[model samples]
Target: MKKLFFILLILNFAGCTSNEEVADRSQVNWQSIEKDLQSALILAEEGDTINIPGGYFKFEKSLLMDDKQNVVIAGAGMDETILSFKNQNEGAEGLKISQCKNITLVDFTVEDAAGDNIKVSDTDGITFRRLRAQWTGEVSETNGAYALYPVLCKNVLIEECIAIGSSDAGIYVGQSDSVIIRNNEAYRNVAGIESENSNFVEVYGNKAINNTGGILIFDLPGLTQYGEHIKVYDNLIQENNHRNFAPAGNIVGVVPPGTGLMILATRNVEVFNNQIIDNRTVGAAIVSYELVAAISEEEAVEADETQAGSAERINSDYELDENYNPHVGNIYFHDNNFQNSKWFATFQHDFGKLFNFKSPFNPPDIVFDGFMEAERSPAEILCIQEKQKLVFINLDAPNDLEDLNENIAPFVCD
Candidate 1:
């Protein structure tokens, strides 16, 4: 039924461009737009420019580019140049660029692709500027997973872009290094901006609102890359209370609605100068991999046999890196204004099992799992100097109330 809705939704856009509009296309004399674009990409030389003239450039198939370098595909401003994939006939993405370098995809709009809107993988020195990627329809599970995705790349910069209505994440940087994503607007997605198994990145000056969660920095098991050294500051993270439409088995499936910001297993992260407000759940949470806490059935049974599932075991089958550092450390939060946030959503994964559900879910602005690497003193492991009137929880023990302390002495740091 959703697929049928997508077809009709795309048809509306396709149907809007009347025959008079089609007859007005005279910038490029091409029999097939997709083929012409493909040939242009292949024939492009080093430091060459492929300028897409101003008009509706629709495609029934994806545009695939691989092994190219020093090329730029520029269009008339994003509002003027429209690329529609309403009836995409082939491929998993609207545009897939791989094994390329110094590529720029800017000044265009890609609308209603069946899969990810733009996927750039195994490429370096990429820039996505002033572009819009969207699925124009009522928000639902049928939306694509990612709007602008860059994976396994280095030296990427994405700025001044707009993305909307992605089922999973609006802008996702995965297994990439040295990235800067700023000045982007994202909403109505499962996660607005997500960094997964990525390293050496900065995400600031972005507005993320009305999504399932905003600004998730996570390192899940079984991925080839490990996440570290990320900085998230000076962004508006608010009102991310959308429904959790993420499919099961994916690590993000555990994220409930109304999450403003969350960091799991990623180390060396700093979040400051961000306006966090009106998220119905906890404002922000930092947890270890053990707290993301994906336990297998066999492990669950063994724990149940011994003292209320309290016995710990070492499971090695699904480790990502050799060190397997599951604890979160070097996370600093300072000088941010947090307001109107509470335990906004219900929990689904191990977090629910470990947290006291009946206890006022969260009037607290910040929550932690009490599992740190102990690399620093109480002043450093997880430092928080941001002052806001809210409750704080330390779920070090599931049943012990003594372990929970309201004193702010343990968290204050410069």
Candidate 2:
């Protein structure tokens, strides 16, 4: 029995080494071989990395990555690799990752798509690093929905990417969890970064500037089922200057532009340590639509019309049903900096009024309390004479005055 066990252990060690060798051999150079897109697709198998060299590959239709695993499609760099789908007719997406796992798409620029720049659905463990997706043409019709969209995926990381001129959103994630979007730049789009019906999402260290809407967490009635448990922290969400870019029939109206950060019907959302500045409209707007208002009005009217001092009082009878009522619950906004906003901040409905506003945009003598005091951080003191209020912003760390001057000071219109 001891001899048999020793032989089994040796065989297992050899098998592991053989598997590692096979994995190393699977890596191939796509540029070394000359093949068309169709033949390249045929040659690509599981655990293969296709390196498209620095050139343009014109395709008639979208390149679909369907039901593959451990596949990497990379390029030399963002400036080098170009996938142009100018004549794509059917279901336009520059690259679609569907029903796959452990996929990596790095160092490429996907431009001029007939549809979305890159669309991923039902995939997991995906990383998009140092990529660029934009519309090359000034024509309004050339842009598409989302530069980088990961839907129904888990464990996604998007870093050092630039998304410009997307008709719908620069980066969009729906029905996903455990997503990290950091060190990305987005501009000239509808929503800079949008997450709908997703949970455990952290959007930090991003610059969302000159887009229509800076950053949005929304849950539309028809499209998404629920939205909860999101954190937006330390993002430079500023100057979303574009107009609404959605086509006539899309559902982007759920959260429109001129909104720096719009959280609609979402619960347990935390917004902290963000520098929201120079937006054309409201810096942060939170509201629910007509459904909640109608319900509240009906309850108020019924209470007003009831008889006085009766055993069955109308106020006691005015119980709101949780099914139809969509209320914003447990939203915590702490330790954020704000400056040069058009409307400053607007909380539309009564539900949004429940927030504890501490250390508002009042400068000169700025008060830092709550989480701001706990962290012992500096406050942003705006000393302009013309503005209505002296804006005092809270920060989690010491502000680099030089970096702030480089980015925000030059763009200050006033």
Candidate 3:
């Protein structure tokens, strides 16, 4: 009986080895396949890999991967594979992946798109790794929309990416779940990362610098209805100073100046452990109406009405909700280091009523005498006449409200 059992185990091991050998032989060498853009698209059948060589591919029209499954489109590196689109067609994205599953785009760069550089819409199991997208033109020239946009997708990951010189947001995601965006850098854009009508998202370990607004979570008009349950932590969000130069297309180019982290009609959002510094304008602006927050008693409201129904409705609802008080809720900012900012560290939900381009807005009442006084342990200093009456708070304090308030009081005045 023991000899028979040994013989059966040997047969099972030999069968497993034979199956592994067959699987290895079945793999495809994508390099030997056609390198033409049209041929690559044709070869992208189920469970196939397309390896793009190191070169530039100028596309007259947009390249699309629509409704495909289990396709891996990879390049040698971000600097090697370049996709350049010079046409300024309306709604033309450089590389669009729509309604697909198990799609992976890795190690490539896209530049000069008329619309979004890379857009993924209504897809699942997508991953964009080591990708770089940029739009370069005069700051006054109106380019397209976001650089990297993923909307209404699930199980998505955007990691080790760089988006620069976008007319709109560098990276924008909307109405998506189970997403992770990390180790990315965004600069010279409208907003760094704008997410609306999304849930279960994590944004961390990113650097957003020198954009109009950095790291925004807005749930305003003309997108999905409402945003909920988002987390943004440990990001270096700073120096978002680029103004809106993109021509008006979507919600981003239309937003007025100096609105950072615009949170409209969003809920259960947590922002913590971020170094928000030198924003020079408003940081974390929230605006919403009672309708947006669903505070008003529900009365036969259509889904279209709840979300801005038409273009006119989008404009009018946004205008009417300018004074809406019920839209802001339970926003928490804790353990953040703010420095040399030109405006308020946190402009509350009602900030729009206070500050506008033509009007003056009063700062919050909390005052810090100076940096020395702001710290928990006041630093010993040589007092001078120039520094007199300039109340200094201690920077060493765990929470230096006094210093922060004193520094911010002058600008908050209406």
Candidate 4:
């Protein structure tokens, strides 16, 4: 009986070891794969398709492509082809494509990148379809800044993608024009599905959930372009209450947890036909750059006081760009559903503290900071179609909310 037991234990241990060996064999040799893949990309002609087979590959350096036209880099499937950069020693991205035209990247998973998972710049036409980008381990400040990053590109289409665990943004389209982001799921990041300083963007049919903030349309100062003519509709912006894990000094670090669909100092935006629910802090917020700037200044001063010369405090002479407009106008929200939990209040950031101070019992569904350009009329500046018994507030922040107005009478669109 003792001999039989010993034989059974030996068989079990061997089975476990064999499984481990099989898992190790699933990952191909990185040196050979890198040499062949890089050679193929460098020697590929126009209208070429580079196919990556089904395997887990590790890379130490970025895969780069430049000045190619009508090229397609496809993989077996998003889950079948995994590119991991956990041990990367060089470069800022897993895959970098620059100065290309009509490039398409589809059906691959890029994870644990040191910087961004995939970055494409200066391309006329770019498409990211059915791709997955994520960080494998804990969500923290060390995660990549963006999962799918496209900048200075025209005719961009990002659809059917999954982005997760980015420290900054899950899907960030910056300084681009004519963009469409649809049917994607973004979660566990600082900001999910963000468009910054981009024009003519349409964000629809996407799920933005479990991030610090969901669906941020922001136009910051000192950027080359301003966001305008934006449309956000038919999206599930819900439960984006994930703790902010962005690195220090990033603009998104100021975003309070539990925020959903925050629009900061952008104009010509239309929000309609969406389900915004269960966000704890606030449902939809329209605020100016001054709000963020003030919070950033306060944090900077606090840091300087604590660390002494580690950070610089903003002085009186500091100035924003002359062409940059700090006020938001021509904004409209309609036909959207907003809901928040009554028991929860955001206390993670300064903005949430202010919300708790003013509306302690229940946070408002929609909030406007009441910072508008003096030259623009009220009608042209803002509009909201009152549906779903929306709870609205005009913060009257210009007058320090002394005249805090909860009346939607003046804001209802005619």
Candidate topping TM-score: 4
| Residue lDDT tens for model 1, 167-222 | 77888898899999999988888889998889999999999998888889987666
Worst 10 residues of 1 by lDDT: 2-11
Kindly give the stretch of ten consecutive residues in candidate 3 with the minimal lDDT sum. 3-12
Tens digits of per-residue lDDT for model 2, 129-241: 98888775452524687789888898999999888777778888888888898989887777788887788888999999877679987654433346678889999988765
Give the per-residue lDDT digits (tens) of candidate 3, residues 199-248. 78888999888777788776654554456777888998776656666443
RMSD of each: 8.9, 16.4, 15.0, 9.3
TM-score of each: 0.82, 0.66, 0.67, 0.88
Global lDDT for candidate 3?
A: 0.58
Ranking by TM-score: 4, 1, 3, 2
Q: How well does model 2 score by local distance difference test? A: 0.59
TM-score of 2: 0.66
lDDT of all predictions: 0.73, 0.59, 0.58, 0.80
- As a TM-score, model 3 comes out at 0.67
Candidate 1 local Cα displacement, residue 83, angstroms: 1.5
Off-target runs (Cα >4 Å) in candidate 2 are 1-35, 139-142, 223-225, 254-257, 289-325, 341-414
Identify the candidate with maximal lDDT. Answer: 4
